[model samples]
Target: MLWGRIYFGVQAAAGAAWWIAVAVSPFVREVTLGGLDPVAVAAADIPLFVVGSALAASGVRPAVWVATGWTLVVAIALAVYATVTTEAGWGALVMATAAVASVLALCLVLTGRVPTAWLIAGPFSFRPALPRRIAAAHLVSTGAQIVVFWGFFLVVVPLVITSLENRWSVTLPFPSFVPVVGAVVLVLASGLGLWSGVTMSVVGNGTPLPAAMANRLVIAGPYRFIRNPMAVAGFLQGAAVGLLLSSWLVVAYGVLGAVLWNHAIRPHEEADLEKRFGDDFRRYRDTVRCWVPAISR
Candidate 1:
């Protein structure tokens, strides 16, 4: 449980760091791709990122408390930044909505007292314990994720940005000066998402499923709400990337990601689950919606 807590805390902090980067990319020199002057905006985001990074490194219960506080702070900062920087009237509203949703989701992870039953860490936790076949599958899935994102960002997005008119202008409905929204969203989502996945993996680690990797089927905490909450959240994170870069190609990549998960990954995972848990897996599947929680049991 201590390991789990530590892992979760670090993940949260890393995520917060990412969010801070996104919220204040204008201020952060490294984040500025080129041509956009975001000195004031990045300046505003620096402290938040620093604080979040510090808290994540601390790795104590106190750190958890700090993470919780920072999550709220990041949200507020993003909201304020959005209101100030947006030239489009509707853009402010959209940014505000996204900010609120992002914050709410972050809060859910930061503050919620997830049961210890779902927390675990160490080399033997999940990754090491994965069976050969299932491990291969996971590798393939992870590789696919990388290929899609990198291919789009490096090759496809640049072409679109060069060819299309007002390409850079096509950002999330946030303040122009605060282009860090997407980056922040990705950071936050990745941090929390990994924390959740690790926790689930720990809990289910030792149990042997018919499928080796399937043994790490977590049914508690975030998983209790949705069968593929992690995947869904990951999609949202991808969307944030598209929004941050204001690239149609990136956004399209995100959409393609959803399709890949739904059509390719989910079915394979479910088949494995059925093989492992049998009737229990079916019962759970029947109760839980794939991505949407509102329809879940």
Candidate 2:
């Protein structure tokens, strides 16, 4: 695909540039690995340069697989080390940007085509389980997911982005009412999310994760009015968090999530639903709007 090729090209260029910088530039060495010896830093980045070049040159399956694994490892290592050890600075920004780019490149490589079937097997499987078991699974999964989401998105990401903004001397001032409004929206959105989770667990007999999605078609509660209340609430919550933090990057991240979900995820999900439920899903989809909440016929 065009996008996959583009990403591969960019990754190759970036990998080569990084290696060259580390070899020749003391500043790059200091910034990349917290003042690691230039020799070691250069050696560490050799794999990055090699894998990227091989993948770009060959465009073969083995090269692609190797590049994917290398990039994933690099991304995870940079993210973990930077978040844990580094203070807010150019180093942090550089590492964060590289990590994000690596992740994007991975996604592009893995999902070469539009409307990937990645979520098909995970969410579409449904076996009839007792209501109590369903509730337990829902509670456990939902709680764990909530912790992971809030810890990463609301706490860690906002902190990093806001620190960068401050370092760059970019200020966005809003009225006192902004935080108040954000707080209200956050609360309301969280409430809606919880209600939607409960409804899914009780009525649909499943949790929200695609791997453990509700077995029954969920049209009760918020799903009755909106096709995707959880998604709506998530967007709202993310935006509200950005508002509270006064971080434009965080707000953009939230918007990006919505865009990705709408374009990449929703199609496969609805397609799976249509395939599984056939006319029932088609009728529900025809009656209920995707974004707007209204009385369903």
Candidate 3:
């Protein structure tokens, strides 16, 4: 996960910068929100950002809850600031965008739809399991999805992107009601993403992470049709992020991500599986396209 790492890293940087901008800089304090004090606002934001950053960096669930809650706070504060002053600031809208992403991410995580740890893009802990520990295992899996996938993509990415572009004060074009469509698409993508994870956990007696690789080769349900349904889900959700925010920059970010994953990550992952599963993986690879699904498999 190049995506996961950059996403969380950006969030951490943005949160810290925002706090500094509001608290340490007197010019920012006096100038923002038509001269209204941003001191209290910055004070409340940094803790959630810090905690969310730490948990998300480690791929844990509390990160999702904390990030979502903090973004909501940022949105409300921006709304209040807008009402008190006539000057339109980009910061509030940025926070609103973050709020949308956070909420969307939370919805997917709470569904228990996927064993999310399986989706983490980078290196992470993947413990082996015993039968009796299955109950606890499921809980841990759900938490990983919330923290890693949900928190990183939705909250962290947006925060980092906004900060890097220095676009908090710049006005951009956004269509009305786009977020509604984005949400629906995100939900659908998440459902597709989770299907395989659920199968791996149920049939393979394991999650999708390499260290906790599934005990069985899953050849049922969606796996029968496409080799990488999870990638499909991730692609959709990634585009939805740009759609929801109406940011071409972020949209480009998501698209480039897909290209890199296709050319770089997928090949390495498949080779590993081929070495692990041998002929079984080879037959499946030949029968099913990496991305395209069979018509009626």
Candidate 4:
């Protein structure tokens, strides 16, 4: 729900800024979408997005459906216009990123995998399930999650970032063996990620998703050495992929993900764990560092 609200708020704010730029700003007004003036289109976005934001804040489900459809159509239209106009730069990159984000958001909403309420709410907690039932279902659920996570993060996002880098002719030179080294790192990181996922499934009785969080405070496998092995593996894998692709932007993206995850998601996760497990989690947290492995044992 917090994320949902942020999405809607950004849309509303962006719509207003876009309108202001296209309407009265002389430099922006000179810009064209496929040789056509975007004045009317810009004018339409602000009110629509503002209303949608209001509706979302009120927890109206229908508003999300409508706003998502509207956003998707606009994104597609702009992307088509950019392609037709031979626009290849930051504008094109922004459009592509927005289009992908809109599509992913729509998919999440449609699948009902996320919480329904869009309004501000208390911290979410997943319903408890029998450990046996969760363990039994872990293989299927965790497998599906792995596929989705890999497809979206490793494939889709990298493709988009690489497109931006290619358009800007950005390249960072590296040794010939860099890719080989990256491959080795990728394999190691993947192994750690998989080991962590399996441990979460079997020992902790849950998936990696916060919505289906573990029942037990697992201290097995990679968890015993590092507090957030999965996160470490994910960051390493992203950086390795950037090295393999030879895209500096993708490497920076990996760094950005680590910062955001640490600041935005980590605190919430730790607070929730402490609330549930009390001193046990605090002790585990104090003993095990987040990014580094314990070596003096």
Candidate 5:
């Protein structure tokens, strides 16, 4: 576990230190590589890296070796780029992070500890242990979610507003990168969505998909506080994207989508759940709020 511990530990520390260095710098907003901001990139990445580091540190699997190695490479590349391009520089903290990450990567890789399957699959393959059919289904469902919801609805449509003349559509102007307000919303919603997916797999013994729904009831994680955490996350994500892009039409679509789900889709899904789960579903549903979280529940 020496390779896993020291290597991934450096990666985790580097990710954190880079963020800190960027945040405290005078040109915080100017810390972009291309057109993309590192905050958003870090927001997506830090969680996965942290999880990988934790697993590696605990010697859970050899997957962390690959994760750490890849992360180290990325950190080094970014550091090199920052050193070359920026006038302000990455500072002493980030320089130390880069140095440590490089050394760790060499140590992990040179020792022949990196697993091939982990390189091919990932540091954390969610469906690798599942049956082929289940894995395929999960991939299809996840692909649809990324393509339809995240790529098309959240990104493409919102970006369209940039070319238009009118700035306002029908948006409520919510969930922007405005201080901690939007960050908090994004973090909570993303956490809930991830929690629901993980809960479906673990507690319910299946992936989160209507077509291949969980066989058993999943009352763990966010499901303990709210019945439909994924839906809540979806709504928040959509709204956040709209607000971030200054597109009222996108926000309107989000609000309308929520309404449709509540009125049209929810009842049918609930009925199906009731049929499948019987009194257990009823009791849980009765205790848990559909939209809002009751933290104590």
Candidate 6:
């Protein structure tokens, strides 16, 4: 029952992310055009919308990857064109927003790849009784993510961009195809983060924590590279958001988020796992660096 709820929650969140991206992309383009017709701009996105919808419905890994890759490629190309040809006013802002929105949309497609078995298996299959403190922590962490990413990164940073444009003078140098390159990187990073988070959440809830909580670690997919790929990916996404908006404050906030996540949240979660998993947990911890990628044992 708990697993079902978690699965649905993840699905709902993923869907919302994609739809929000779709809605926002046009708005950003409109801002760039300065009240020009949005129909032409939006028409270009029809293929992306159709592909994304198909991936969601089919849930095939190859289709998801192909759709996501195409979206990223096209978005990046558009961003490059905008950067090179358009002036550095509302047009730049619009292009940057579009890039970020495309990245977020890619994330949604990646999230759909989370395995179905994880959703079907009840939480109790892993933990007969979830500790109250751990459950509370997970809830709080998820809530914090929503608030920080949506409220601060998305809303506040855009407002800051507007304020800076209106009040402060700023200049950014872009290489010939840098905008497109940056767009591609942003999409890939965001997609990886989304995939990692969805997978980790399933592992966190599905795996039986070691009595010491150290040994029952997941070592597949992105986890093969890093102990906390999800968190690292999230940090990257946040940094990209800061860069896209050209806001140092947002960047600082992203840094602060990483610190808080590592120091406060990760520790508690680790302790819970250790208590649950025991010596096996220690073995896994010893083999894996918390965030850095290492050669798998």
**lDDT per model, in order?**
0.51, 0.69, 0.65, 0.70, 0.60, 0.51
State the lDDT of candidate 6 residue by residue for 1-297, as single tens digits.
Answer: 233223323433543464456467865444444343446655654445444435433554464444445556655554444445442245444334444444444444455322323322443122422433354444444445545565665567656654555432234443555445545656777677655544444445332221212123566667766667667766766665656655554555567678867864566566656777788777778878887788644
Instruction: Point out where model 1 deviates above 4 Å.
Output: 1-178, 206-212, 294-297
**Candidate 2 residues 205-248, lDDT tens each?**
87776766777889889998988998889888888988887777
Q: Candidate 3 residues 44-108, lDDT tens each? A: 66667655855655566678677778878867876666545633355665677667656655555
Off by over 4 Å in 5: 1-148, 161-180
Q: lDDT of model 4 at residue 47?
A: 49
Summing lDDT over every window of 10 consecutive residues in candidate 1, give the lowest-scoring window: 116-125
TM-score of 6: 0.41
Residue-level error in angstroms, candidate 5, position 137: 8.2
lDDT score of model 3? 0.65
Off by over 4 Å in 6: 1-182, 201-216, 295-297
Cα lDDT for residue 197, candidate 6 = 46
TM-score of each: 0.41, 0.61, 0.53, 0.61, 0.48, 0.41
Q: For model 2, where is the 10-residue window of minimal lDDT? A: 121-130
> What is the alpha-carbon RMSD of candidate 6 to the true structure?
17.2
How does model 4 fare in lDDT?
A: 0.70
lDDT of 1 by residue, 1-297 (tens): 343345444544554565456556553323222232445644644444345434544544454445445545645554344334432222233333334333433434456533222222232122224543434454454445445654665446645543331422334444674347777877776665655455444555522212224354578766787777667766776677666666554666677778766864566557757876788889889887777775344
**What residue runs in model 2 are displaced by over 4 Å at the alpha carbon?**
14-47, 50-77, 80-178, 198-221, 245-265, 292-297
Top candidate (lDDT): 4
What are the RMSD figures for all models against the true structure? 17.3, 5.9, 13.1, 7.9, 18.9, 17.2
